[model samples]
Target chain A: NAGVTQTPKFRILKIGQSMTLQCAQDMNHNYMYWYRQDPGMGLKLIYYSVGAGITDKGEVPNGYNVSRSTTEDFPLRLELAAPSQTSVYFCASSLLVLPDSTEQFFGPGTRLTVL
Target chain B: TQLLEQSPQFLSIQEGENLTVYCNSSSVFSSLQWYRQEPGEGPVLLVTVVTGGEVKKLKRLTFQFGDARKDSSLHITAAQPGDTGLYLCAGKDTNAGKSTFGDGTTLTVKP
Candidate 1:
């Protein structure tokens, strides 16, 4: 399986601009998540979906939106980008949340710079 | 909100030496995971400890979860240059369906 894959390895956006970060998983995972990693800040969850048509806000959901229309795809949208949004974004998926099956498969990550 | 704090935010050591890094939190978790990340890449899972006081070892690395389920530690024996990376610990909140990540410990092993 290709596991989880994210598009646009690198991107630069002007202030107030918008873009969609695409993610897909071939594992048919029911849980997909979007996280951003800032220098020395680790990974912060932006949004997540339990399944298609369902999404929830995470710790840092501001300026971001997500849609999980299929089991394989979970895309993150950044509207009116700001310099604060500059960070590396990662997409991950897991088959289940049980103790033994919660291992998350993560994508290579997309580096975003907002000016 | 549950927060995880990692110690020795940055460590530089010579190859063949041993080192340990810690991840502590005040809140309990259902399970905890360890991951290693290289520059420009996402983290890859190293191991997950569910039961408290559980110990799992991978090659030269050993991972242990605290008996109270509030902390964990990673110990590397005879570290190598390949072991240099960002080590992160994440506490899983199954009920919330999310894992809280630690700031991560950056390790640099010199040959």
Candidate 2:
């Protein structure tokens, strides 16, 4: 299983520009999440999906959107990008929620730079 | 909001030395996890502790969850250059239905 994979390993966007970070997992996980990591900062969740057609806002969801149309794909959209959005983005998937299972498989991550 | 704080934000030590990194929070969690990340890469899960006072070991590394379920510790014995990376702790709050992450501890092992 390719586990989780993210597209555009690196990207640079101008202010006000928009882009989509694509993520896919072959593990058939029901839970997928998008997180951004800043230097010295662990990670801040942007959005997550319990399943296809169901999404929720996480800790830091501003300037970002997500869609989980299939169990395999969960994409993050950044609209009107700002310099504050510059960070490394990661995609992760887990079979179940906490108290039962907390093991999350993560993607390599996409490095984004907004100027 | 639940928050996790990691101590010794950065650590540089010689090979063969031992070290411990801590993650503390006032909020209790249903489960806690530890992950290690390398430059330009995403974090990889090291272990998860679900019970209070739980202890898990992975090779030269040991993970312990606080008896109150509010803190954790990661101890590495005889560290090697391969162990150099960023260590992160995440707590899962069942009530909040979300995970809180600590700032992370950066460790460098010199040979």
Candidate 3:
């Protein structure tokens, strides 16, 4: 199984440009999440969906938007790219977030650099 | 906001040595997870401890959750070069229905 997969392993963007980071998971997970990791830091929650059509903002959701149109895909959109958005973005999915299911599987991550 | 703090931000040792990394939070958690991340790849789940004082072992790695459920520890026995990477600890807050992550502990095991 591909588990979780992300497109455009790496990309370079200019200030004010917009783009979307694609994320898909084949594990049939009920919960999907988007996170960003800055250098020398841990992953910060960007947005997440409990199920298709049910999305919510996470710890750091500003300047970013997400849509979960299907159970297997969750895409993050950056309306106006900024230098602060430069980081490695990761997509993860878990069976569920109940007390018994907490382990998350993550994708390789997309590296974005705003110049 | 729930925050996780990891100690010994960096560590370097020769193979066969042992090391321990710590993650602490003032706020209680319903469950906590540990992950290891290699150079250009994503983080992989190592273990998860829920109950207070819970202990789980994976190969040569030992994980422990504090009795208060507000802290955790990861100890590697006879570490190998392959164990070199960033170790992160994340906690789930049932109240918020979300998880928070620590900055991470970077370990380098030399051959």
Candidate 4:
């Protein structure tokens, strides 16, 4: 089964442009997250949703927006992209949390470059 | 700030060598996960340690969680070129439903 999938594998945008990174999961996981990884750096959380219609800010939420309106989709939006926003973006999904929650499953990633 | 910090940002070694990477933090974690990532692909889960002082082995790889629940380590025995990749550690976020990832450790194994 396709666990997690991300769209627009690669994109180039001029400054001030807007775009959305699409993410979908087929596992019906309740938790979804968006993260960005810079070259040689660890993944930084951008935004997350615990379930449908529930979104929250994360460590690095600036210049990004997210919506979780369904159990299978969590999309991140970049409005007015900046050079600093150029990075590889990833989406992840996890099953409902308990003391024994499983590890997150990740998407291949979307590479975005802003000029 | 990242909840976890990984050490030895980069490592290079010859085949058949042994190596260890560390992930440390001041906050207590309910669970810590290790992931290995290749170029152009997402990180894949290697193992997850939940109990303090617990050690888990997967083939030639060994993972241990610190007694205090604030640190963890990944040790590779008889490393091969196939083990070269970016290694990351993520800790479950106690304040939320998500987990925080540490800056990854890049490993290069030469044959």
Candidate 4 lDDT over A41-102, as tens digits, reads 99999998989999999999999999998999999999999999999999999995575476
Consecutive 10-residue window with the lowest summed lDDT within model 4 chain B: B92-101
TM-score evaluated only on chain B, model 1: 0.99
Lowest-sum lDDT 10-residue window in model 2 chain A: A95-104
DockQ-based CAPRI category assigned to the predicted complex of candidate 2: medium
Specify the CAPRI tier of model 3.
medium
Query: How does the DockQ of candidate 2 come out?
Result: 0.74
lDDT tens digits by residue: candidate 3, A56-113: 9999999999999999999999999999999999999988746858788999999999
Model 1, A1-110: lDDT tens digits are 88899999999999999999999999989999999999866899999998999999989999999988888999999989999999999999987846767888999999
Separate DockQ for every predicted complex:
0.81, 0.74, 0.79, 0.83
lDDT of 1 by residue, B10-108 (tens): 999999999999999999999999999999888999999999999999999999999999999999999999999999999998587789999999999
- Clashes by residue pair, model 4: none
Angstrom error of the Cα, residue A108, model 4: value is: 0.7
What local lDDT score does residue B98 receive in model 3, on the 0 to 100 scale? 64
lDDT of each: 0.94, 0.93, 0.94, 0.93
Candidate 3 per-residue lDDT over residues B4-94, each given as its tens digit? 9999999999999999999999999999999999989999989989999999999999999999999999999999999999999999987
Whole-structure CA lDDT of model 3: 0.94
TM-score of chain A of 4: 0.97
> Model 3 residue A64 lDDT?
99
TM-scores vs. true structure, each candidate: 0.98, 0.97, 0.97, 0.98
In angstroms, the error of model 4 at A79 is 0.9
